[model samples]
Target: MSYDTDIFNALRHRLMTNGFEHGQKVRAEHLRLEFGCSASTIREVLFRLSTIGLVEFREQRGFRVPEQSRALIHELTHLRVLLEAEGTAMSIRRGGVAWEARLTAAHHQLSHLEMRLQSARDTAPFVDLWFDAERHFHETLISACGSDALRDTHQQIYCRFRQQLMIEDRAFDFISENIRHHQQILDAAMAGDEALTRQKIHDHLARHLITDAQVEPA
Candidate 1:
């Protein structure tokens, strides 16, 4: 990978995982010294991230991570439910055995980590592993749907959704419920029941919706 691409990805991950605080000014100088790159290179990377809604640029203030919003989280949750449910349904119709195998494997890994985390005194050690596993499971849900555009859009939104909740999610208070939700999703998918899979996906993320009435896949 190219140096600039490396820096961009590192910054993207830091932004997504709460490496930098929300609404904090991105210090290009510090990054330049740390990355051993030029100021303009960092600027280019920040601008690229800005296009994806991971970072925001103000005319005089330069770049900063976007602040969290409850309304935004609700909207993101709704979109996630719609896209994930549709994608899983499409996968069920077209994925065959290969997709099922992949989804099962993904869930196994996530489930193992969650089970261990559920009883851990300190969740710090499992956080990164859990993030990767959780993302892998969800991404595998849509991987065989035969729509790159859908996958790309879902990925962008997923990252933003994680970014908004990174601080809140680190507490691990919801891990137990998440375990049940993920198992239900896995079982529904394995059974090749599209409607049930859709419902399970919605249930997994319903808390983030925070609306008066819970939304289901349409």
Candidate 2:
């Protein structure tokens, strides 16, 4: 029972990273051998991951990592911009110095890694660490939004968004621009400019939004 989280996280991390090729079948029997659990247990874990859009099931194909969808990516990107913008605005209003400090701390950690990544000839060694730090900064931007429902929903969207980022951008070619965007967002939030903060967040992810994705003003 206690190890259930370990199993779930193990599978979730794999799906998020390069562990499984897009649309590759996930085998319960193979995972069962690795975890020393029943195939049924592995199936249960994969089912949970499916709910988060990291995995999918077909009529008879069992479980597999989802195929990347340009449409789905655009939709998820729009939602992320909306949720993150609104949440950050709320945090700026409600969260005071404490929230700012946490946000600053999170940004510092993320930016440090981004700077290193900016110049590295090989990014593989820093990939996972950079992803974790990046997620932490965006998450902290809304940590003080004070609504569990909003936070929970954003988390689900973010997981899918992160997975998409992994699939589409392995080389980190835009890492320089990303570093700038992250810094600007932090500056806006720190200066208590809600509108600007919202805009910065949107700008950071605007590339992901297809031209057809008509995002409303934040």
TM-score on alpha carbons, each prediction = 0.94, 0.93
Candidate 2 lDDT by residue in tens digits, 87-132: 9999999999999999999999988998898888888899989889
lDDT tens per residue, model 1, 96-214: 99999999999999999999998899889898899999999999999999999999999988989999999876548888899999999989988999999999999889888776554
> Which ten contiguous residues of candidate 1 have the minimum total lDDT?
209-218
Instruction: Report the CA-based lDDT of candidate 1 relative to the real structure.
Output: 0.90
- Candidate 1: which pairs clash? none
True-vs-predicted CA distance for residue 88, candidate 1, Å = 1.0
List runs of model 1 lying over 4 Å from the truth: 213-218
Which 10-residue span in candidate 2 carries the lowest summed lDDT? Answer: 209-218
- For candidate 1, what's the RMSD? 3.3
Model 1 residue 34 CA deviation in Å:
1.4
Error of 1 at 78 (Å): 1.3
Please give the clash total of every predicted structure, in order: 0, 0
lDDT (0-100) at residue 107 of candidate 1? 92
Give me the displacement of residue 93 in model 1, in angstroms.
Answer: 0.8
